[model samples]
Target: MSHLHIRPKEAGADKRIINITPESANWQFVGFEVVMLEADDTLVVNTQNTELCAVIISGVADVTTQEQLFSNIGHRASAFDGIAPYAVYAPPKQELTINALTSLEVALCRAPAKGLYPVKLITPQDCVTMTRGSGTNLRHIRNIMMDNVDAERLLITEVITPSGHWSSYPPHKHDTDAIPQESALEETYYHKLNPKQGFAFQRVYTDDRSIDETISVEHNSVVTVPKGYHPVGTPHGYELYYLNVMAGPKREWIFHNDPDHAWIVNP
Candidate 1:
């Protein structure tokens, strides 16, 4: 199976640009898509068997469900603006209508649902932003829906790697179900570059080097991690941003870092 999945930006398409399901990526639990809507446009979303988290990349939108309506729910101009994003979670079997208040760009992160959870709107105030690593390896991490959140199996977050730096450093893997040490989770990285022309590199590999690949990722690229330690790097002049969606047997994140680079995290 191909470990690296790349979906380029498709212009003049309907609203959905990148659509990734478990069958499409050959993964078990993770699914993701990016949608761009013009002003006043509307789209109906149904979470049939999967629970979805809709993240506002830019512009304003009113997301209405049978239980609640989230109006004027975005404030950032772009993902690179370093501002907290607006997001909403819809449980499985729920139907939602997204009305574009402005030209909107949104990301739909999904996973199979085992139980129905309450619909929650995760605003900027609900996000936890922190800086990770030190010096050149420093990067910004935004925890949108973490394990602490009341969710079934999805963990969503965003990472921003400054120019000339690395995010997801110390290459980590969560492919084994080793209890507190590591939990088996399938993950997907949906990436966006600062200048749209800029690019980034991602390496997914295993200890035996049996599963290994170094991918060149551009704007609107989606990278899937079936089982490996994955690391990402941005070039000298360009910044990199990516949204991570993960789900598996457990609802927590327990990972093991590459021993060769684990010292960096300690030292």
Candidate 2:
């Protein structure tokens, strides 16, 4: 398997599906994990030196930070439910706990921090929903912790692409630190399909083709984009959903589209 393509291990209902750290990814920032929990089960997160953002992918969860209680924190039985989720952010060196009020699925996104921020509960009301592209390029986006939100090193979001649609389209890249033009950000795409048995396609490549892979992504799998113009497509029958975790030397998310495919955006 290519280092960028990560497959999930066989997991039971109450187990972590995927876990990636900066050391494991050979990158400077970005860490991700997915977990499933039965009702009343709990998980304690040791933030260490990294900030943590826990996004409830499904079911309800209660988050506790120090003395604060953020309760009943989620909606929708699936990401395809067309609703935004609840997210909790915990600062570095601190610990937070998640108590699953119901069967829960959550994604933990992390990055290095200086302990400058506080624990914050980002509700669906705090998120901005926008639809990008049109026709077969159409996709729905939930901007959970983008630039407008208060966070030091994370720019998180979730996207839903309808069947017969494309997403992260026009083949965009953000591997350069040229501030005005593009920002260098390492990203991960954690994908899930409506039917557990269905699959999707994602392509990661550079202008020089130094890194190129067209992956058949199964449910709960992830694709790491260290540097490339990455784009995704869904099969005609399966709706696609993905959570994106991005971070880098800076926190900006400016990207440049591939010139060869830029014309599509103009028409």
TM-scores of the models, in the order given: 0.96, 0.97
lDDT of 2 by residue, 81-192 (tens): 9999889988898788889999999999999999888888898999999999999999999999996578889999999999989999989999999998999999999999
Residue 99 lDDT, candidate 1, scale 0-100: 98
**Model 1 lDDT, full chain set:** 0.89
For this target, which candidate reaches the highest TM-score against the unseen true structure?
Answer: 2
For candidate 2, the per-residue lDDT at 216 reads 93
| Model 1 residue pairs with clashes | none
Candidate 1 lDDT, 179-211, residue by residue in tens: 888999999999999988999999999999998
Predicted candidate 2: what Cα RMSD to the true structure? 1.3
lDDT (C-alpha, whole model) for all candidates: 0.89, 0.92
Q: Clash pairs of candidate 2?
A: none
Which regions of candidate 1 fall more than 4 Å away from where they truly are? 1-3, 9-14
